[model samples]
Target chain A: MKVLATQTKSERTQAAILAAAEALFAKNGYERTTLRDIAALARIDPAMIIRYFDSKDALFARVATFDLMLPDLRTVERSAIGTTLVRHFLRVWEGERGNSGLAILLRSAASNEHAAKKLRELFKSQVMPALKYAGADAYAAERAGLVASQLLGLALCRYVLKLPPAVTMSREFIVAEVGKTIQRYVAGDE
Target chain B: MKVLATQTKSERTQAAILAAAEALFAKNGYERTTLRDIAALARIDPAMIIRYFDSKDALFARVATFDLMLPDLRTVERSAIGTTLVRHFLRVWEGERGNSGLAILLRSAASNEHAAKKLRELFKSQVMPALKYAGADAYAAERAGLVASQLLGLALCRYVLKLPPAVTMSREFIVAEVGKTIQRYVAGDE
Candidate 1:
């Protein structure tokens, strides 16, 4: 019973560290955020972070570990794919769960090499496989690249840069406008 | 004659400082880079940077100053406007003059609020005026926002993140693929 109790406490501590790390990374980015800063925010000894996560790079990898939770596009309606995908992304970014992992990765990717690599990996591992639904055989890679550029660009403008127009845009408008662009990139003829 | 010589030397020093600041800002980003670092790279005393630029914020504003040099889009053939604009951006980014100012802004924008504000200002000042050619009227701001998303995303993927597919795409291919999107954004029926 005591051992189980100790394990539960350890797990809680680990969770706290990850939460603090994610918040700091999203706010300050990878290069500027330090283990000491994370530890301070987590209310734990700095060494505790080292014990749990091994290294800053490792901690960041863990924080940035996210599943796009991409629905199998093969199952989505052909014409509705674009709107469905856009709505899904909206939920991923603004849903109750929040998109801290992606937000952290994007915030750091501009200046941090590690974050950039992870983003590319996410594209390969998550985005590429999903595009198989588009049935774009020879142009699959390019199609996926186009989709990424539009989605990521929307995220950058609305969330990071917070450009007035992008920020003020209604969800319905974004869904209609960006949705059409994604539809073309994914399914339009060359 | 002495006064004229002094002014010439001062102008030379100012140019050097701007160049060094641009490089370091592009590399280390705004928050991490220091005036001392810029001075070291420029081979000038730190105090000289202060004398020339006043402050780091002011120095960065100067470094980030860029004119998109947009063409009068209304004059271009309606069918060819997208290709013309994409070609122009390709030149701006990869041309001999280089795109250091824009690169510096993108690199620093994620983590620095000031840099992000500067980017929004650039979008307002340069991009919006150019989109007047699209004659979007009621949808002008939305149209400009969409254009910014696509172009900035291309820059982020090809230049900053260096995503493989985006980077490997040929100029001709990019012009074709992205040009269609921009044309749709600018002129397609909502």
Candidate 2:
């Protein structure tokens, strides 16, 4: 099912296109990135981009966009859920593949109306639904908002601003503290 | 003196320039704001921008920059400090006149390296030093980082992303939850 190694020429071309778009979008942002730039980066003709994705938005949706499906919180112990969430969120933010797709969407929110809409949608569908199913409840919404504010702010301070103390904080410490804080937000006084 | 009785031409010019810069930076970001736009908005010669601030960085330093100067935690009521802090943060983010500075700086973070550097400087000099002075010790560095992450993440999700729950959260509730969470981050239990 994994297509055992060698990709077809078209497949390789598509991957190359996606890779280029990701890098460009991550570095320059969504509004600043043009089809010409993606083509330039991918070494493909501009026509091929339209031929494949039809438009910039479609290409962006495929390349620089995504939903972060959180792991099921039901299976985990309630007390540990907050801490577990902290760890998981950190993993999502600082995952091995360099910058995250969510990070890109977040950065793009200020400049691109479309990106902002997508960011809102990700929260409505993927994020809140999952938390609701996890029994976080309606009262938990504000707390979740507060938690999200702090977590995303930390990501911004650490990666984007590169604030020293934030930049210096170890992942283990971050996971523990942030996990506990999120626990308090979503679950309430323990 | 309140200076409300006498609005000097220079003061009006300065105020107008700052307002224009704030809106443009918030919308288009630091890199995208043009001196011509600021001058046109202020109805001053573009030459005056160079005369007043020297450069965009200088203008930004004067206009779009601020720091969080936290009060001494040990002296304040421990239970109330968190709520107070969240409230203050909210005020800074939502302040009618000067608040957009944080938003512009945040938006410019990815594209403008100088803005990012200035933010780090502000954190180290203002936030870190204050937290350290209040009671944060050797391990305080990382703790503050975690707290910032939580706070900023929540802001980005709520304000920048406009996530539903984040968007709808009342100011009072956010302060209660976020403030308490921050307390735990800095000085409370595991």
Candidate 3:
């Protein structure tokens, strides 16, 4: 019962702000959307956004706080790691998870300094560590960065912009083809 | 002399518009920017944008046009080719030639329908035939798309974001490592 009631009003308000921010940011982007826009969307006062996230950058970090997990990558056969990684990425990105908004952030993160810093921190904490432990350490961080480019690029083509051929391809086909390339990236004969 | 003299005021105006659009689009993006804004930056009337480019998307397509002259790629040794291609690309993207804008368009292209369409067209015309001719017809379009992603991702991380590690690494090291991966994406160890 204590765990059930662990939810606090402030936390709920914060979550509401994040949720509203995601929709607006996704619909628009970091530059166009304002604190007031987010507040109006969340049906909360603009000050609440400042209260929870401290700044627009912090709010963006929370909105972009997603993980790229490869389904239990620790124990898989070394040969299958690449395919597994690519397939799982396609599943999460193209399926109901719908990474269109995240894709926008990734594309914009380069020029926008705030987004860029958060992205670097995210790669260091979440991505680079997993890649390092995966025994890709020789070029793990760089390779991880490269792989991110590929995944984000695919999202750009298939999810965000939605090209005809890319959109038309079945998941299995994409996994098989792109999977082969990523296979070399993570655990194949490189 | 005739060509220079024959350049009409309208032609100059159109060139100005394209120039303005490229800079603004690179700095901001497709959605956030407006014709009024482009006109203001160009010191021209907003109506000029519509008159010249017909539409924002059309103007973007015009400004984002790219040409990839990958000559005699097949005959080159596979090992050296990777490094060469990487170096060439790094040069292309880093130099003030056209690639900074190219990088932005490629990353953000997947975020917009018109831009994405143009990307697909660019691949079909510029990249696909090259790969196909190089005996990579099995999945040339997809492979080209992936390559574009890796390149754009690196540009975003290294140039636009200026991630220290990525930026610190020499062009040769990046080309050598990333070239190996790109080698696999092209035709693989057949």
Candidate 1 structure quality by residue, lDDT tens digits, A70-139? 9899998888778988998888987677445576567678666767888899999999999877755788
User: Worst lDDT window (10 residues) for model 3 chain A?
Assistant: A104-113
Q: Pick the candidate with the highest DockQ.
A: 1
List chain A TM-scores, every candidate, in order: 0.71, 0.66, 0.63
What are the models' TM-scores?
0.74, 0.69, 0.66
Model 2 CAPRI rating: acceptable
Residues A95-165 of candidate 2: C-alpha lDDT, one tens digit per residue: 76543556555555644555677766766666665676555455756655665676667767776668777
What does the i-RMS of model 3 come to? 3.3
Q: List the residue pairs that clash in candidate 3.
A: none
Query: Which candidate number would show the highest TM-score if scored against the true structure?
Result: 1
Assess each prediction's global lDDT (C-alpha) against the native: 0.82, 0.69, 0.67
Model 3: lDDT of residue B33: 82
- DockQ score for model 3: 0.28
Ranking by lDDT: 1, 2, 3
Clashing pairs in 1: none
